[model samples]
Target: MPRLEEITPDNVSAAVDIKVGPEQEAFVAPVVTSLAEAYASRRTAWPRLVYDDDRAVAFVMGNFDPDNETEAFRCGIWRLNVDRAEQGKGYGRFAVLAFCEEARRRGHRRVTVLWEQGEGGPEAFYLRLGFRPTGEVLFGETVGELLL
Candidate 1:
């Protein structure tokens, strides 16, 4: 199994090179840049880069936020990606599971994942990991949630 590590400037370039397919390129390009910024920010967001041995293979970026005026923390899982050459080897699933576990460890009660509308891969993958669609779409992205 590949081990997950925190994203850093040293590995950010390699992580940004991971791609799913030609169709996903346009979708993931901007996301990669945004994730890099989040990683460099002061917020509590956790952006991770996964690796097998010393090679970068996947990534997951997310953060914990307080809901409304309550003390409850709602976790938001942002971007998740596994290299096309490394897909179907369980890397993506492992990354998501690890991210969720980390979110729980951070005291979040729920973790939400947002997927692009046309990305069947993400929808199916998240579903397989126990996330259910919330019937809510935000800015062309579908929202799914898994209670921790």
Candidate 2:
């Protein structure tokens, strides 16, 4: 069974080791980079690792800042990286569902995600998860939202 774990000294290194395939790399940032961003935005960043027993399988980060000037950034999936070896094993969807639950718990009515469109991008996967494009684009990434 896979479970989401809060990043800690004991598991921080394991989280950092998570990686996506080379083709998917252009779609998202790595766990280490996401961790750095989380540190910089500790007040709003929520980073977690998905572990199947003792094995780390994926990393997910959400940014929750209700007062942010940008509506999309107020609550959204900031980064998600599933290990190259763990792709298609449901870890990515699990991480995303976990993030959505967290958003609802945080009093958010919806959570948004920005995905770049390309042959190997996550646009299709996110859409399949029920995130509808809001017709907004930020920094060249299509803005998508899922009502909670």
Candidate 3:
């Protein structure tokens, strides 16, 4: 089984390198760096690295917050990436589950994720994991939410 650990600046390089293929590599690098900076600025955000033994295989970054209007605490699954070489081994699912559990422990009542339409990407994967579309789109991405 893969283990999830908190991401630190020291391991960000390895995390960036784990992205699979040229297309993914281009998209992942800048986003990971931005997420890292966001996490650093927002200390309450959760950022994690998934590792198989000593090799870093994936990453997830998000945060928990209480919706003022709804008065419900919710978790956001902002960014998730599993190394190309490590894809299809169930590692991504396990990592997300672990993150959800952590969010629950932190008092979140639900978790949400957003995915853009088109191309090879996470929309189908998030759907497979039981996340329902909100029927709302933002910045060209579909928003999805799942009750914990």
lDDT of candidate 3 over 6-66, digit per residue (tens): 6567887886676765665533444467566665758546777899899898887776655
Candidate 2's C-alpha lDDT?
A: 0.93
Output the lDDT of residue 104, model 2: 88
Kindly report the root-mean-square deviation of model 1 from the true structure over all alpha carbons: 2.8
* Better structure of 1 and 2 per TM-score: 2
lDDT: worst 10-residue window of model 3: 65-74
TM-score of each: 0.84, 0.97, 0.83
Off by over 4 Å in 3: 25-31, 67-74
In order, candidate lDDTs are 0.74, 0.93, 0.73
TM-score of 3: 0.83
What are the root-mean-square deviations of the candidates from the true structure over C-alphas?
A: 2.8, 0.8, 2.8
Model 2: residues with Cα > 4 Å off, grouped in runs: none
lDDT of 3 at 77: 74
The TM-score obtained by model 1 is: 0.84
lDDT of 1 by residue, 1-148 (tens): 6888876678878877777677676545444775756857537567888899988888777766655342222577767777888888898888888888888887876888877756444677788889898887776777788987
Q: Whole-model lDDT for model 1 versus the true structure?
A: 0.74
